[model samples]
Target: MAGKELHVTDIFLAVQVEAIVAREGAIMAVEKGFSNYVIESDSLQIITALRTTTTDRSVIGLIVEDTKSLMARVTGEVTTHIRRTANIVADCLAQFGRNIGANLTWFEEPPNFIIHLLFEDCN
Candidate 1:
């Protein structure tokens, strides 16, 4: 991790659970005291997932609800973006995910063994 705690700048809200997961993270941040945030992402799937309501009301629904509720509390507006270049921070975070390995330990810091994962097939 960096010496300074990073803030959620822009978020990429989409229909995909991955995007929702990021939104959920943003929501969690706001709950923790962040007054504003931006969601940046390039996935159309994730965007649609967030805007539509499906029958799949399992854990994902709970996440969506919790995220929505959290977003509702934010004084700032939730924004969206479609360009990959526009989402450097999120992409960086996703790259961080690549380092976490298969068994994702959300609460744990990413390990160095996973560094190679970032360079693999990276465009």
Candidate 2:
């Protein structure tokens, strides 16, 4: 069975940190020993950049670089782009983070309020 796991991080940034969340997911996969897995994101551009050798020079590029490097540390890793509608848990978690004003949060199990969403997604 897949052990329950959730990670959320927030930081005060002067600039936009759009792609960094994807990077954080990569970082989590490596740190948590996800040997064979597919990482999904709503952003196609971020997923494409991760699958290419092109250099990213943007402010969040360093984070993306770190993500790429971390992805390399594991085996059988795949990245895919998904629609936001299919990623409701992640979307809710992000909103939860913002609402709670938490700089960082990790949920070893599903959050209580999201139980219904999880059930709905099953169908």
Candidate 3:
């Protein structure tokens, strides 16, 4: 298991940022040679955009399209919508990343700060 936290300098809308994050995550997964993976996001719009065949012409259309292209390269790829309430660990990590303003990756285990949240999430 691994987690990635990216800090972006440019500002974007919430949905756009979500799309960018999803795209980046997909890229990372492909780079790591993950044949099967799941992409979960609290943004329903992003999940819906990915699962659909229609083109998105909005501000995030390009990012969404690129994300879809990457998703095609992986076998058994699953994208799903998760409630923010159920995604505490991700939210905490995102905040932590923003606060430090750096890109971080953790392999095999999560950061100590979010360990408790992970346990709670499991429950």
Best by lDDT: 3
Model 2, 7-73: lDDT tens digits are 4356455222436666666667777787765678887777877888888786667777888888888
10 residues in a row with least lDDT, candidate 1: 1-10
**Candidate 3: regions farther than 4 A off:** 116-123
TM-score of each: 0.50, 0.71, 0.88
Tell me the deviation in Å of residue 1 in model 3: 2.1
Error of 3 at 22 (Å): 0.6
The residue ranges of model 2 lying beyond 4 angstroms of the native Cα positions read: 1-18, 103-108, 116-123
Order of candidate numbers by TM-score, starting with the best: 3, 2, 1
Off by over 4 Å in 1: 1-17, 48-60, 101-123
Residues 29-86, candidate 3: write the lDDT tens digits: 8999888778889999999999999998989999999999999999979999999988
lDDT of each: 0.52, 0.65, 0.84
The collision pairs in model 3 are none
lDDT of 1 at 67: 59
User: What's model 1's TM-score?
Assistant: 0.50
